[model samples]
Structure formats: structure tokens, C-alpha cells
Target: MTTLYLLGSAAPPVLEIASVIEGAQKRGYDVCLGLTPSAARWLEPQLTDLEQLTGHPVRSEYKAPTGADVWPRADVALFAPATFNSLNSWALGLTSSFVVGFAAEAIGKGIPLVTMPCVNAAYAQHRALDRSIAELRGMGVSVLYGPDGFEPNQPGERRPEGYPWHLALDAVARRTA
Candidate 1:
């Protein structure tokens, strides 16, 4: 089975992550779930259920060097609903979060990577956002943004179902095929 690292940030779309995992599984992926720290907190109650669903532990923090690897090597990775902070941090090569760190290293390791941000129009106006997206693309990471991928809504508008998860999954399928 294709191993997929499905990482996420603390965006509203992350609340429905279980369905996203099921979507990946239905597409024949062996999924491993990872989240940003705040995302983990947001989904704390569902963590165990998510672990059971993926058959892998949900990791938000780095593992101890002494521990053995729990997840399989990823053939592809999808970092969806990546918040503004995480996206910018990733492009800047700051990997304080586990998800961003793994993605940063994945570039050097040649793992196929895709990302879709879930920022509002207000936050998307930041000058760094465009630069960050460009940086990720320069590293061969397929960034799904703007009109086709994830169009930012107004500040308070929530559209979890509108997140184009299929786009993320499909991009990985193409990359790893």
C-alpha cells in the first residue's frame, strides 16, 4: 500500500480530519496522521479515534531519539489546511513544529510533497504568504492555492467541506505513480 503522511494545521477544516483520512484510505493509501500542536489540541478528543482509524499513532511532537520508528516511510505527503504561521515557517526553513520539520526534510530526501493552506483573505494578504508559497514550489513541493486549490474566504466564514482534499490526494497519486 502507498504510505501517505497526512499532516494538518489548526485550521477549521482540520475538525473533519477523520473523513479526510477515510477519503485517503478509500483511495488505497496507508495513512499516517500528523498535526500541528494547536491542531492536536483542537482534536484532542478525537485523537484516539483517529489513531484507530489510521492504525497509526497521531504524532504532533517529535519522537525521542531512543525510540524506534512507528510509521512506515512515506511515498507521498499532503500538508493540507496549513495555517499561515505554519506555511510561512515551513518556507523560511523553521521547523519548530513536527509537521513542518518533516516537510522541510522531505524536500532533501526526495519525498513527494503537497500542501494546501487554509487561511482567510485577511491573513492571505500578508506579503510573506506569496513568497512562502513560491519558496515551497521552488523546492518541488506541489502547493495548491489561489483559484484552483484553496480560495480563502472572509475572516469569519467557515467552509470545512470546501477544502479541496481530493486535489491533495490526487497530486500525491500523480507524484508517486
Candidate 2:
């Protein structure tokens, strides 16, 4: 089976993550979810449901060093709802969280990574963000943003309903193709 490491960050779109997972599964991918701490907390109420759907636990924190691997190695990974902070941090090689750590290493491991950012226009305009996106793309990370992917909204606007979860799955499918 094609195993996907689906990483979710603390963004409004994290609310629709289940749909993304189901979409990927329907496309013949087995998924393992790795959420940033805040994202995990945001999805707390549905963790059990998510686990049942994926047949594995949703991991936010790192397991004990002695613990065995919880999920199979990823064939591909998608970082959905990739936040401004996570984007910049991952680009800069920051591995403070399990999600970011795995993302950073996935690149070196030759694992295809697709990032679907959910930042607002203001955040997307930050000088660092463009550089980060460029850097990740330069490293072969498929970043879905702008006109062809996700179009950012103005700051303070919440468009959780408008988040393109299907786009993330499509990006992964294209990359894996």
C-alpha cells in the first residue's frame, strides 16, 4: 500500500483534515496523521474517530526514544494547512516538533513532500514566506499555493469552509504519479 504521512499544522483548515484523509484513502493511500501540538488539541474531540478512520493513532508529540516506530515509513507526505510559522520553521531546519522534525528529515530521506499552505495574504506577503516556499520547492517539495493552488484571503478572515482539502490530496496524487 502507498503510505502517506499527513501532517497538519495549527491552521483553520485543520478542521477539514478528516476529509483529506478519507480522500487519500479512497485513492488507495494508507494514511498516518501527524499534527502539530495545537492542531492536535484543536482536533481532540475527533481523535478517536480519526484513529478509527486511519487505523492508527494521531500523533502530535514524539514517542519515547525506546518506543518502536508507530507507523510505517512514508511513501509520500503532505503537509496540509501548513502554517506560516511551520513553513518558515521547516525551511530553516527547525525540528522542535515531531511534525516539523519528520518534515525536515523526509526531504533528506528522498520522500516526496507536498505542502498546502493556509496563510492569509498578509502572512503570505512576509519576506520570509516567499523565501521559505522557494527554498522548499528548490529542495523538491511540491508546494501548492497561489492561483493554481490555494489563494490566500485577507488577514482576520476565516474561510475554513473554503479550504481546499481536495487540492492537497490532488497534489500528492500528481507527485506520486
TM-score of each: 0.97, 0.96
Kindly report which residue stretches of model 2 are placed more than 4 angstroms away from their true locations once superposed: 159-161
lDDT of 2: 0.92
Q: Write the per-residue lDDT of candidate 1 for residues 1-177, one digit (tens) a residue.
A: 999999999998899899999998999999999999999999999999999999999999999999888999999999998999999999999999999999999999999999989999999889999999999999999999987698899999977577788887788788888
Q: After superposition, which runs of candidate 1 have C-alpha atoms over 4 Å from their true positions?
A: 159-161
Tens-digit lDDT string for candidate 2 (56-101)? 9899999999998989989999998899999999999999999999
lDDT by candidate, in order shown: 0.93, 0.92
The true-versus-predicted C-alpha distance at residue 94 of model 1, in Å, is: 0.6
**Number of the top-ranking candidate, with TM-score as the measure:** 1
Candidate 1, residue 167: lDDT: 82
Tell me the number of clashing residue pairs for each predicted model: 0, 0
